[model samples]
Target: MADLAKEAASLHKAASGLRTVRQHTAKPLQEFESASHDLSALGALGSLLGAKGDIEEGMTTLVKLAKQLDEEWETEAKFMGDVSDAFDLLEVLLTAAARAEKG
Candidate 1:
């Protein structure tokens, strides 16, 4: 019974830590997504304006930057998903522990 309690406590703590990580990462992820959208719009605008030479090069750089941001966002999203999964698994473990203790 005591062992089950300890395990449940540990699982709960792990879930809480993962939630904190998710919270901290959420804002930066949102900001990256917003910036990527803005960059794409700027690139389209440059094309519509008939950019040439240096202007075209700048636009290209912007596109690259946007792509990089998108890639980073994807990586972060995957990390968040993994963290969420871990939290879910911990929750399940805690639930199981509780049931075991009760039974």
Candidate 2:
């Protein structure tokens, strides 16, 4: 029971850390989109090579990927929190059941 408690504590800590990460991720992803805007200048060079369409297409793909990553990370953080809460509830129920059995 002691070891189990320790592990549960560790998991809760990790979940908290993930929630923090989820909060911080937006700024970096926004910066990434800002940087991608600078890359649009490459379109001029691509035009000379007749690859402007390809460059624009690639840029669109990159933006979509960044958005996807942001959404997925948000989802994962939510899942971690939900799982942590479930464990806490399970622990409470188990303790109650154990005490009832002893009585």
Which ten contiguous residues of candidate 2 have the minimum total lDDT?
1-10
* Maximum-TM-score candidate: 2
Model 1: clashing residue pairs?
Answer: none
Supply candidate 1's per-residue lDDT for 23. Answer: 56
Per-residue accuracy of model 2 over 3-40 as CA lDDT, tens digit each: 54665677777767765764676687677766655656
Cα deviation in Å at residue 55, candidate 2?
Answer: 2.3
Per-residue lDDT of candidate 1, residues 23-61 (tens digit): 566576567645544444456665677643455466557
Q: Cα lDDT of all candidates, in order?
A: 0.60, 0.69
Clashes of each: 0, 0
- After superposition, the stretches of candidate 2 with alpha carbons farther than 4 Å from their true spots are 1-7, 22-24, 40-44
